[model samples]
Structures are given as C-alpha cells and as structure tokens.
Target: MKLLTVLFIGLIMMGPSDPTFKVGEVAPDIALPNMNGEIVKLSSLRGQMVFIDFWASWCKPCRKENPQIVADYMKYKDEEFENGTGFTVYSISLDKKKEAWQKAISKDSLIWTTNVSDLMGWKNEAALRYKIGSLPMSYLIDGDGVIVAVNPRGDKLEKALKKNRKSESWFKSLFGY
Candidate 1:
C-alpha cells in the first residue's frame, strides 16, 4: 500500500501544471508603472479591447514587430468592436533599465498606447505571473476581460482584431451598438 501510494504521488507530481492561463478565460490582472511612473492596473482598461503585450527593449523580434502593432493600434484604436467599444494596447516591457525601455518605445514610435514595466527584465512581475517564457508574448482581451487571442503577431494580430470588428454600418442597421 505504501509503495503504491508513493508511485501515485510521483506520477501526480510529474504531471504538467497549468501555464498561467489560456484563451476564453479572464486574463489575470497586472499592475505596473506606466511611462509617467503612475501605477496602472490591467483591469482599469475594462470596457475596451486591450492588447496585453509582453516584450523587451533588447529583444530584436519585438522591435521588428512594433511597427505592425503600431499600425494596428492606429487602425483600431478608435474603432468599434463586437466585444468592446474601443481598442488600446497595454504594453509591458521586460527591461532592466528605464532609459533603454523608454528609448525603445520612442524609437519604435509606440507612443499611442499605455507602455509600462516593472524594470525587472526577466524577473518582471507581469512576465512571471503570465508565465511568459518567450519575448513578444501577447494576448487580446475583450471588454469583459476574457482573453480572445494569444501571441497574435503582424497581420494575425490585425486579423484577430478585425475578425470581431463591428461594421461601419452595423450601428445604423441595428438597434444596439
């Protein structure tokens, strides 16, 4: 009985643990310092479509993808969504230095969104909480806080946002907006 119990426990311990979260679930909240050093909470952006991106100043791929994300941001920021009213990005940088992060944001022209960081690099609180094992991790959540997409990039990012977009004439043709 003792040996059987030990084997069962061992198997249970070796089983895979859930990674942070997944699509369709409400995204876990993250509170960090914005560019202005103001504490911003992820939940505060409720009632809008939010893109939560985990990236870094030193990450080349993140830099490469910024322009596309910026373009998407501009395209959708003021637009209506099937699940939310407006769109915005909640960028979390995993940079150890403040200057490098700020510089990257400016150089990338990521000026239209809420860019934030704990300045802890890999040890960033949001990264750890989200179980971010790679650079440029991203999630798209709706107004209700439910995650709609994971790791969306480039046209895929824009596509995910657009797939659920409310048509320009949807309002005029429907009773509810």
Candidate 2:
C-alpha cells in the first residue's frame, strides 16, 4: 500500500510538467529593451492584436523570414479585414551583439514594427519563459491577451489576415449593409 501510494504521487507530479503555451492561454507579458535603449512591455499593448516573433541573427531561416513578416505587417497595418481585427508584429531578437541586432533590423527594413532584444543570446528571459528551444518561433495573441496561434509561418500569417478581414466585413454587413 505504501509503495502504491508513492508511485501514484510520483505519477501525478510527472503529469504535464512541461508547460507549453497553447491556444486559449493568456500570453505571458514580457518587458525588454529595444535597440535605442527604450523599454517595451507586452502588456502595454492591450487591445491590439500582437505577433511576438523570436529569432536570432545566426539563424538562416529567421533571416529569410524577416522580410516576409515585414511585408505582412505593411499589408495589414490599420486595415480592418472582414473580421474587424488588426495586427502588430513585435519582434524580439536573441542576438548576442547589440550592433548585429540593430544592423539586421535596419537591413531588413523592419523599421515600422517594435523591435527589442536583451542581447543575452539564447539566455534571453523571454525565450526561457516561452520555452523556446529553437529559432523563428512566433506567437499570435488576440486583443484580449489570449494566444490564438503559435509558430505560424508567413503563408499562414497572410491567410489569417485575410480571414480576419472577411469576418470583419461580414460583421459590418450584418448590422447595416
């Protein structure tokens, strides 16, 4: 009976020990310094849909996707699609060198979006909190602070914007049109 009780307790403790951010979960807020030494906080952007992108200068895939994300941001800025939703991409860099991060942001033309980095490389607090084990991870959070998607690709991002636009239109039409 004693052995059984101990085993049961251990099993219960081991259940779901690895916490993964998932859909419907409230995104954990993060605060980090931007390239110009200005602090940015995730919670401060309440009521705005946000995309949190985690990347590093050394990751080739991240480098390739940077332009695509920038384009998506430009395409959706202040434009309400069918679903009455707008988005902002908040890029967080994991680069070890501050110059490298600033240079990459400028070269990639990621100027219109908010960019921040702790210059801690992989030891960034945000990365550790989000359990990021790889580069190019992203999270899509709704205005209410709930995570709607995770690790969405460029194509997926475009599709999501279009879908939201359509929904917004439908809502508008239902009321007056």
Candidate 3:
C-alpha cells in the first residue's frame, strides 16, 4: 500500500503536461484583435494553407524576414496548395504597444488581412497558448488545419511551399479528375 501511495504522489508531482508545438499536431486556433480592432481567428482560414508567424515589432530578425514573407505571399497566394487553391499568412504579433505593431505591419508591407495581436508583448496570451519561446517562429498549416512544418524560412520556406503543391488535376483525381 505504501509503494502504491508513493507512486501516486510522484505522478501528481509531475503536473499536467502542457501542449507544445509540433509538426503533426493541430495548430491551436488564435482569436485576437487586428490593427483595426477586429477579431481574427486562425481557423477561419481553414480552406487554405496558412503560415502562422509569431513575431514582434522589436525583433530585428522578424522585421528582416517580413520582405521575404511578402514575396512568398505574392508568389503563392494564388497557387494551388495540397488542400486549397491558394495560401495565406496569419501573423500573430507579440507587441505590447498597438502603435508599434501597426507601424511595423505598415512598414513591412505585410499586406495580409489576418494580422492579429493581444498587445501583451512577450506575455501575449496567444504566444503562451502556442508555447512560443523565441521570435521569428512559424508554423506551416495545411488546409485541414493540421501543421505540416515549422519555421520553414528563406529557401527552405520556398521549397516547402513548392513541395506541397497539388496540381488541380491531382485534387480532381480523388473526386474524378
């Protein structure tokens, strides 16, 4: 009886395991306000592949990567992905100041309409939900809302996007082609 009691105590002490970001897991949905004070939800982009970027206006690396993100969006926004006909980015900012966040979005020319932030900075609730430990982190989610890759940037980002392309005919095959 004492052995069983000790085992139970040890298990309790371990605490509940918090979910961490992973390639195959369903990326947690985010519902936060955009620069316009409107709420955006990640699940709303269900029919398209999405790149969920965790960034900050103060993070230089994230600022530097913004141009490439814009380029990739311009290049693939209309191209066919594995689960949809196009792609989009859902940028979640970790900025405590709304003005700074908006300025960065404008300055970077991140034209996506899905940018969101809680204005909590490093303590942003969405960041905590996703277990973000660093800036410039990203998750590539498929049309079905399952994460397919993480932090695919630069040439790697482009390659991953190209590799996931599913020809229209390929998609049609499952139905009739």
TM-score of each: 0.83, 0.80, 0.82
The residue pairs that clash in candidate 1, if any, are none
Residue-by-residue lDDT tens digits, candidate 3, 1-177: 999977754543332243366778888888998888999999999989899988888877789888999999999999888777689999999888888999999999999999999898868888888776666778898898888877876677877787778864476676774
Please tell me which predicted candidate would have the highest lDDT against the true structure: 1
lDDT per residue for candidate 1 within 1-177, as digits (tens), equals 999977754543332244467789999899999988999999999989999988888877778899998999888898888878889999999999999999999899997658999899879999888877766678899999998887777788888887668783475357553
* Ranked candidates, highest TM-score first: 1, 3, 2
Any runs in candidate 1 off by more than 4 Å, and if so which? Answer: 1-19, 168-177
Model 2 stretches astray by more than 4 angstroms: 1-19, 81-85, 166-177
The alpha-carbon lDDT assigned to residue 119 of candidate 1 equals 93
TM-score of 3: 0.82
Per TM-score, the best of the predicted structures is 1
Residue pairs in steric clash, candidate 3?
A: 172-177
Candidate 2: residue pairs that collide:
81-165, 82-165, 82-166, 82-167, 82-168, 82-169, 83-164, 83-167, 83-168, 84-168
lDDT per residue as tens, model 2, 20-125: 6987899999999987788999887766667788887766678888888889988777766432356788888989999888888888888654798899987998
* lDDT winner, 2 or 3: 3
Q: Local error of candidate 2 at 47, Å?
A: 1.7
In model 3, which runs have C-alpha deviations exceeding 4 angstroms?
1-19, 168-177
Give me the displacement of residue 16 in model 3, in angstroms.
Answer: 21
